[model samples]
Target: MSDRKSSGGAFLIAAFAMIPLLPVASCVSEGHAGGAAAKATGTETTSQPTHATYSCGPRGTLTVDNFRTSVKLVDPEGESVDLPASPATQQSRYGETPYALVLDGKEALYMKSGKEPVTCNR
Candidate 1:
């Protein structure tokens, strides 16, 4: 009787262990629908866009709409631009020609063509 109880407990433990693998297995078998975009931009988006207004002190406030693969940036003067995700060794970065935004937690460093980099906080 004790042997049967141990076998049942082992089965139960194995069943619980497999639960965490279910989502990963489903994704593997079904494949990701946005896999191509994800690979191109190197961003896996699982939530909605985050909108924030960052205070840059002397440089003024910057309105940022951060998306999965792109970031829409509005300068203090109200000029707006959309930047795509760029590769970074650490921290999140988005760039488009004369504009680049690097986000580190609640702070962001904005760089443009003819201006100095501006540091802003959320």
Candidate 2:
């Protein structure tokens, strides 16, 4: 009967020891959704990066880096234009000329200040 009592005591101690870890285990299982809770509690969490590339017809290619929150366009002339993120487009201005990039379906549209829009495919 003493052995049974000792084992029961040990079990109770083990269960008590695990109580503090339950919150940590739950946080780990919540994944990114837990980040919202941390933020709500005034904790800071690092954001993940999202990078995407789009090929536009003859205009060139566009690369978006969500981490830096910037967009870069490469032209066939090997010139690169760094554009700022806009509400629904990436836009850049050089001298008096303005350029805009928009994505539709699997294609991208490149528009200059006054020229016709160029279509590019992925």
Candidate 3:
């Protein structure tokens, strides 16, 4: 009876240990889905229309697309914002909040709502 109790306790401990991993697994699966969707949306090509994706923790994902004449940004909520390509720094307002995205080489700095800029790499 003692041995059985010990085995059951060990099993419970193991199960408890695995609880934290569940959320991590779900996040990884969600990230995979996001990647697949981004690719399907033409964000992984190497042509005239270039694309880039950045992960911003709780702020969510940021996708940038550079067309021949214009630039497009997609926020975490799948909302699209348009901006011109003339300036290296692009600023826009989403809803009532203002945001800025600065592109330098293969990196981008995203800032909004008085929060520190989030850096994203290509």
Residues 24-101 of candidate 2 have per-residue lDDT tens digits of 544454466667656633421122124456675455665544322345666444556765544222121111136554
Candidate 1 residue-wise lDDT at 39: 55
For 62-113, candidate 1 gives per-residue lDDT tens digits of 9889774788989866789998766422126677676777666577677776
Q: Rank the candidates by TM-score, best first.
A: 1, 3, 2
The lDDT leader among the candidates is 1
Question: What overall lDDT goes with each candidate model?
Answer: 0.65, 0.46, 0.53
**Per-residue lDDT value at 91 in model 2:** 23
Ranking by lDDT: 1, 3, 2
The true-versus-predicted C-alpha distance at residue 58 of model 3, in Å, is 4.3
Q: Name the runs in model 1 displaced over 4 angstroms.
A: 1-49, 88-91
Model 1 alpha-carbon miss at residue 53, Å: 0.8
lDDT of 3: 0.53
RMSD of 3: 17.5
Provide the lDDT at 15 for model 1: 39
Angstrom error of the Cα, residue 102, model 3: value is 1.3
Off by over 4 Å in 3: 1-49, 86-97, 113-116
lDDT (Cα, 0-100) at 93 in candidate 2: 15
